[model samples]
Target: MDSKNKQQNDQKKSTKSNGNSKSQSNQTKSTSSTKKQKQARFGEEHEGKLLEFFVEEVKDIYFAEHEALKALKKMEKAATSKALKDSIVQHHGETEEQIKRLEQVFELLGEKPSKKKCEGILGIIKDGESVIEDTDDNTMVRDAAIIIASQKIEHYEITSYGSLAELARTLGKDDLAELLEVTLEEEKQTDVTLTILAEESINEDASNE
Candidate 1:
C-alpha cells in the first residue's frame, strides 16, 4: 500500500511540474509578443512624425527659394561689378531650376507643391535688402555687400538642402535624396564662387572705395 501511495505522489508531482513549465513558457511568449507590439507601434509613430516634419521643411524651403528669386533680382540690379551681376544671374537661373526640382519632389510624394511661410528666409532676405540700402550704388562697396548677402543666402540653401537630403535618405527616399543632393552641390559651388570673387578682388576693391 505504501509503495502504491509513493507511486501516486510521484505521478502527481511530475504532472504538476509539467503544468508549471508550460505555464512559464506561455507567459514568456506573451511577454515577447507584447514587447514586439510596442516596438511596432513606436516605429510607426516615429515614421509618421519624421514624414510630417520632412514635408513641412520642404514647404519652408520652397517658400524660401521663391523669396530668394526675388531677392536675387534686386541684388543683381544693385550690384556694380559685371562679375557679381553675372554670378547673380546664373544663380537666379539655378534657383528657378531648384524650384522645379522641388516640385518634382512634391509630386513624388503625391502632394501638391505648396509654400509654407518661412520667417527665417524672409528675415535673411530682409537683411539682404537692408545691405543694399545701406551701401551706395555703382560702387565696389555695393558689390561687396551684394556678395556678402548672396553668400548668406547660399549658406542657407546649403544647410536646407543638405538636411533635406539626409532626411530623405532616412525615409528611404533615395530619388528625393538624389535631387536634394544635386541642389546642395550647386549651392556649395555657388558659395565657393562667391568666396573666390570676394577674396580675389571684390573685398580689396571695396576696401579702397
Candidate 2:
C-alpha cells in the first residue's frame, strides 16, 4: 500500500512538471509575438500628433524655398550695393541646396517632391514687397527688404526643422534627426548673418540717410 501511494505521488509530480513546462513555452511564444508586432509597427510612432502638422509644414517649406529662389533673383537685381547683391546671390545658391536637401528627405520618407501653398511665407514676402516699394532709399531698401524676408524665412525653417528633428527622434529615425539638426543649425547661422548685415551695414546706412 505504501509503495502504491508513493507511485501515485511520483505520477502527480511528473504531471505538474509537464504543465509548468507547457506554461513556460506559451509565455515565451507570447513574448516573441509581441516583439514581432512592435517591429512591424516601427514607423507608426511618427504617424500622429504634430507629425501630420510637420508634414504639411515641410511641404510649405519646400514651396517657400523654391519661391524664394525667384524672389532672391529679384532682390539681387534690385540691390544697389555690391556686398548686398553678392549676399543675395549666395543665398539663392543656398536656397537651391536647401531645396535639394528637402527633396532628399522626401525621398527618404518614400515621398515625391511637391509644393504646398504657405500663407505665412506669402504674407512675409508681401510685406517685404511693401517695404521695398515704400522706401525711397534704394541703397538700403533692398538690403532691408532682404533682411525682413530672409529672417522671416529663417525663423520658419528653424521651427520646421526643429519639429522634424523631434519627430524623427520619436520615430527612431536617428539619421533623419541628424540631418534635420544640421539644417536647423544652418538656418540659425543664416539668420545671424542677416542680423549682422542689417545692424552693421543696412541699418547704419539707413540712419545716415
Candidate 3:
C-alpha cells in the first residue's frame, strides 16, 4: 500500500512539473507575440514630428537618387575610359532600383512619395556637368575628371543612406532601414571601385598628359 501511494505521489509531481513547464513556454511565446504586435502598431501609428522629419530626409535621398541617375548618364558619356563608362552604366541601373525601394518605403509609411528639393545633389550634378564641359571628352583627363565627379556623388549618397538607415532604425522601421543599408553598402563599394580605377591607371595616365 505504501509503495503504491509513493508511486502515485511521484507521478502526480511529475505531471505537475510538466504542466508548469508547458505553461511557462506558452507565456514566453505570448510575450514574444506581444512584442511583435507592438512593433507592428508602431508602424501603423500616425506620423508625428520625428516621422515627419524622417520622411523629409527620405524625400531628400529620393530626389538625390533621381538627379544622380541623370548625372551618371552624362558622366558615362563624358568618360573616356571604357571601364569607367561601364561602371557608371551599372550604377545607373542600381540607382533606378534604389528609387523603387524608396517608393516602397513611402508605401510603408502610408504616404505618396513627394520630393524635397535637395540642393546638395543639385550642386553636385552641376559640378559633374561643369567637369564634362571643361574637359575634352576624348582625353585621359576627362576620365580622371569623371572618376572624381562620380566619387563625389558616391560619397554624398553614402552619407545620406547612412543617416537615413540610422533614422529608420531609431523609429523602429527595421524593414526600411535594411533597404537603406543595402544602398549604403553599394555606395561604399562604388567609391572603392572608382578609387581603384583612378589609382590603377586613369589618374597616372591623366598626370602624364
Give each model's whole-structure lDDT.
0.90, 0.75, 0.85
User: Residues 21-49, candidate 3, lDDT per residue (tens digit)?
Assistant: 77875775676568658855765574466
Clashing pairs in 3: none
Against the true structure, candidate 2 reaches a TM-score of: 0.73
Tell me the lDDT of candidate 2.
Answer: 0.75
RMSD of each: 11.5, 11.3, 11.1
Error of 3 at 121 (Å): 1.0
What TM-score does model 3 achieve against the real structure? Answer: 0.76
C-alpha RMSD of candidate 3: 11.1
lDDT of 1 at 159: 93
Q: Give the TM-score of candidate 1.
A: 0.87
> Cα lDDT of model 1 overall?
0.90
Question: Model 2: residues >4 Å from true position, as ranges?
Answer: 1-53
| lDDT for each residue of candidate 2 in 1-209, tens digit (9 for 90 to 100) | 25698578656655655566777757756765686578557536535555666667668878888877777787777776777777777777777888888888787877788889988878877777677767665667657776787787678778878887888887667876887787788788888888888888887886676
Models sorted by lDDT, best on top: 1, 3, 2
Q: Ranking by TM-score, best first?
A: 1, 3, 2
